[model samples]
Target: METTMLPAIVQVLPGDDFTVYAYCNDGAVRLLDAKPLLELGGIFESLKDPAFFRERLTVMNDTVAWDIKGNRDETCCIDLDPCVIFRTAPIVDDPLENVI
Candidate 1:
């Protein structure tokens, strides 16, 4: 529910430069750090765990935004919450669909 101020700095893991992102809406974030999978031979279970992602991920916002400082596209959704992956079905549309 925070706004204006950028969130805290998250650390980057080994391998690809992907990082996490945090925003004010829906306490959004994304775990862009593609390290664990790379380290585990490209198979990291946490990526697909519903509860785990729900516990550590967030929706960020209905619109797509990126974390400038994150190096990667990771971002924040909640304190450490997961996201509702399928809730986006009804909202998916062309980029210009909602434009003025």
Candidate 2:
């Protein structure tokens, strides 16, 4: 029998065009496109601002999240499920490979 482990997000980097680079525990960098979600309106309205989006990007609840209020309040912020991201997002090259 084999056991499967889900990847956990360790870091997040906001990219241009509403994309996010999620670094996972399994050594994978996944790219998440947030443009469609931002266009949904409602709670996501605050994320439409590119500056706010990049500034607030963070890791919360063990996943890619936004500390919208800057308080680190998990419940008040927006977060994406790690499993969803690991499964749905395509693995991408680390954007900081040359920087660090």
The candidate 1 region of ten consecutive residues with least summed lDDT is: 7-16
Model 2 misplaced stretches (Cα beyond 4 Å) = none
Q: Give the Cα lDDT of each candidate.
A: 0.32, 0.92
Residue 53 in candidate 2, Cα distance off native in Å: 0.4
Q: Residue by residue across 5-90, what tens digits does model 1's lDDT show?
A: 33332321111243333222333333344334435632244434433433343322333222333333455322222232213212
Deviation in Å, model 1, residue 85 alpha carbon? 12
* TM-score of each model, paired residue for residue: 0.20, 0.91
Best by TM-score: 2
